[model samples]
Target chain A: MSRRAQENLVALVVLGVFIVAIVMAFDYGQRARMVPLPIALIGVVLTLWQLVWQNIRPADELNIDLLEVLTRREGEAVARNVSSNFDEQSAHQKRQAAGRESVACGMVLLLLGLVWVIGLLPGVFLFMLGYFLLSDHYSLPRALSYSLGLVVALYLLFVQGLGIALYHGWLEEWIRNL
Target chain B: MIDAIVAGLAALMTPQAMVFMFIGVIYGLVIGILPGLGGVVAMALLLPFTHGFEVAATLALLLGAHIATIWGSSVTGILFNVPGAAKSLTSCFDGYPMTKQGQATRALGASATGALLGGILGAIFLAVSIPLVRPIMLALGPSEYLMMALWGLTIIATFSEGSLMKGLIASVLGILIAFIGMDPVTATPRYTFDILYLMEGISFPVAMIGLFAVAEMMKLYVKGGSIVDRQMTEERSTVWQGVRDAFVHRWLIVRSSLLGVWIGVLPGVGATVGGLAAYAQAVQTSKTPERFGKGAVEGVIAPDATVGANEGGGLMPTLAFGIPGGEGMAILLVAFIGLGVVPGPDMLTKNLDLVFSMVWIIVIANIFVTIIGLGVAPYLARLPALHANLMVPAVLAVCFVGAYATRGQIEDVAMAVAFGILGYLMDKYHYSRANLVIGMVLAIMIERNLHLSLTLYGSDFLLERPVAAAMLAFIIVTTALPFVRRWWKRRKLAAAGGRA
Candidate 1:
């Protein structure tokens, strides 16, 4: 059955085609549009050419298992750390997809961003409290200690030390007015 | 020269300077011990505190912290085999082995000494090389520097495991990503997707911390396994023996410093490469090559020397040419500009003394960092074996804070986490993250330089610049040499198999 590798290849091919359409649409950009047009044009060309070559290649038939294929490799090679479990490699690949959720990455980022817009104390408080309640990384005492440490440290650094403006959230506003 | 040395010696003698030196060294060690934090990160964190401070005191604090981190990283590598930074990779080879043999103290001591020695040698080279730096830098044209950058990138293919083609693709992706911000020559956005933040482009530190630091933290959380038990054998390791191992490897320190300095002199390559390359070269030439990655003192010394040399070498281009040597140094160069220092021959003529003073700072910082680093390593070595749960929460908090503090943007934190997951997948899949980082770092320069050369001279740019043509030829030859060697080896192996 066709799997993730095939899907990735197809996605890349489709992306290449899409970029080519962008390149074509932006062909007029070189003449009329000045800086970004010409700059992006070169990037589009290089990216499209690379994607097509990588994805739409005639992959020669080999004895290598489809599931066990490594998309990339790095660092010093060792004798044993490499996965040699060919029999259930496909299943392992499926399991590895959980990593691709990448939601945790996005969520953590958004969480940090949200704090800046609101205020540091509020941000830290919300983040710790949220994690304490929601995440498996919770114990009431630990969360309390963490939250207290985070809030106090941030207050010391950004507030007491740097003397930068405290994030003007509702709590901060109330404190200021009081 | 006489005046410069006397001034430097005077600077080192100040009580305040000595105190800050210890502070910087210990700070660096602590920062270095934590995974995903390196000298660059530590220095960046310390940069804020440097404002309005006395120059010598500031340098001591900064350099001390930076030097200590290198030693700090080796602690993790030796006891747990987790590299603190890319440079510490080789430490795992010999470090962990010595640890398993219950020689953790000795290994830690040796690493500390190596770091101290390497730091001094690198700083000395930096000091001696200052006067000659300008002429060499002035001689280096864009074409030659471009070739140098390409040569560094080609090493990725040599180092990468599995398909070179895949590594190339990853590198290209990295270059393309590096293209995400502003075009240097034209000052236009290339791939900012209409975001204002994209206009300035992504900060290198933010990207690095995220890609290396945040992503790494996430991996640790998911893996749910501590590679070391800090609780096991908390007895103080032999300190004097580690110190003895250092003296035994004196020649190795000089050899590694030269390696680091040579690589550092290149425009784009910096301390990380110098450190790892030093480690690799040390291992390659060792009598017992097998002993690397298992806590060989050379692993620590080689990287430390290279890192110090890289700082000096990186300064060469940044002061002479306007181009930066590496990311962290690039920021420092910007600070120089903020202080109204221009980077050209004129500045060299007018500010030779200030340049000498800076060189002096590097030397003094290294000496102080070493003393502090050696003194602190045994104490710091005790940290890694702490329960993962405790370390994880605090470290995770720092990761978030560090990511946020870098650019003051939360998206960066997210980017780091995404990159971390990507890093983990890449790590597991055998994809070279170093290639990705290098590609990301150098991509803008390659594109911008090529664009300038093209725009300035059109397609006949190479012919117009004969030096460029020659450099291009060099780049082609260097890139091709690896494939040729690979092909020959494969052919020989296949022929032997056939004959059998």
Candidate 2:
């Protein structure tokens, strides 16, 4: 997606949240609805204003220097031209980042699932080892050692020192029951 | 006052008390350096151990750790652009910028020294103003707190350096998120969507870890460069230079510390507001206000100073009126009740010695933390130079674990990851995560106070409450001054150009 489209989409998400808040407020008691209703109403207005403004303004004029008026400092010209939506990167770089981000998000979700199924310590150990190896940043043996050391340190600090109860996980519970 | 001070010093001088204080200071620093583990958690963990200890020793352990964490929280903010706690968010404005410029040592030093001075000054202020603080505290009500919260919201203007409209929209969204859980006043859940975990609300620390630490790692992972650009420039400033920077900005430290103490004194305003308010004040009052949020040393110093002094201010409500000023104080109040300490107007008289003991701990703990902070800063500055590959997984793992350990719920880990993605997108889109955090911080306070103010005083509350009226006026001026000044300058520029 282009920068402008992305900006509008995000604003629309925010506007949707406000609408949800307003709808939710209607379900509550009068006293409960009192604050949320008004706040959400204002939120909707502001977000709508932002969305309309983004659409109306030309892309070149989007970078409004809000701080310049506030500071009034000399020689420290606030770079008003910097666009949040458009970075100085090639299409390939942007694509590469998006791919990496997907992989990263996937890894986090995988870790969460692993924790639920196997347990925190084992899940963490496996994730670290797998991540290091998958990234091709370290050799397999090096990944194993780093993951081992991390798990040991985590066990010592959180479990032994703080005496926090770690989650036993679904796998552990099933094994125990059997 | 002299007698109280002497008694405080004598009580804290005991071998056991001293040892506990030192240990607490060290423990607090470690917790503060870690992302998402704040002073509230530190106090909660220590609350169990406070059961059998002597009152003085217990206060030393709890208060010492609490005070140290204020500066300790600044460490990651300065070094890595990741706030260890919400209170350290303001420090990241300039602190991280300084790190990128290879002045991490200097920024850390300024933070430590500022925090040290602020803590001592705040303690002294509390001691001297004890007689005058009560009536002032008693006079303020929900109306006043609501106004103070609004004042905090005004600082969003400072953080909205990119786009004002986008900043406001982002902040409103954040405030809406804060309404997710059961309302503190009416006990009605707003937007839980029937999820069981949503009943408790989104955890602030968990959101913060996602918004800052995890999102930052994602950016680093994709960008693939050391956080510190050592090739561009060598370390330009030393740890001692940072110390000198703090000393040079002595008046700024004093002013920010007083602001912090004032915020801390108010029930539930908390250090996060104090930090942001102090940063705002620093920017507003400076000759070169634009230097702020861009590695200005004053930016680092101001927030740290406020946090340091905020500890003393927090004790006012907890000790005198039985009201917890902040989350950490709420936990400490529990410990206080467990220790058989009664908090009331009578605390000013009967438990004066114990009160003084807490003050002395703040003073002594600041000194200890500053010494340790200075000693460790140079070594800590090197952390950002590590390869992103190693740093990314390690930080992400710790962040996920920390988020889970916050309430022992894996769902929170999921929430953190979700927010992490949200935070990354926000950064990419210039949607001001700082404003979002501010909105979340103030939402409950603002909503609760607004309800109480209206119900109690009706529609004409502004006319009835002079203090609230004055605060409203202050907020108006604070909000308008920037725009008004900008307009005046633009007009002058246009006129000058026409004449030329």
Candidate 2 lDDT, A72-162, residue by residue in tens: 4233323444444355567897798789878766766787788889888898888888888877999999999998998898777667756
Give candidate 1 regions above 4 Å deviation: A1-139, A150-178, B2-4, B26-115, B161-163, B227-256, B262-303, B314-360, B378-388, B428-430, B452-500
Per-residue lDDT of candidate 2, residues B1-500 (tens digit) = 68978997889899989999999999899888778888998888888788888889998999888877888889988887789999999888899989998899999999999999999999989899999988898899999999888888888876664676677877888888898999888898778889889999999999999888888887787677678768886777888999999999999998998988899999988999888888877877776665777789999999999999999999999998899989999998999899999898788898788899999999999999999999998999889888887888788778877887788887887888888888888877777888899999989889899889998999789998999999999878866665566568779999999999
What fraction of correct interface contacts does each candidate retain?
0.07, 0.46
What's the true lDDT of residue A109 in model 1? 62
Minimum summed lDDT over a 10-residue window in model 1 chain A is located at A60-69
Error of 1 at A100 (Å): 12
Q: Residue-wise lDDT of candidate 1 within B11-96, one digit each (tens)?
A: 66678877877777766766676555677777777676676756656666765666566667767767655567656655665676
Give all candidate RMSDs, comma-separated. 6.7, 2.5
True contacts kept of 1: 0.07
Q: Give the TM-score of candidate 1.
A: 0.71
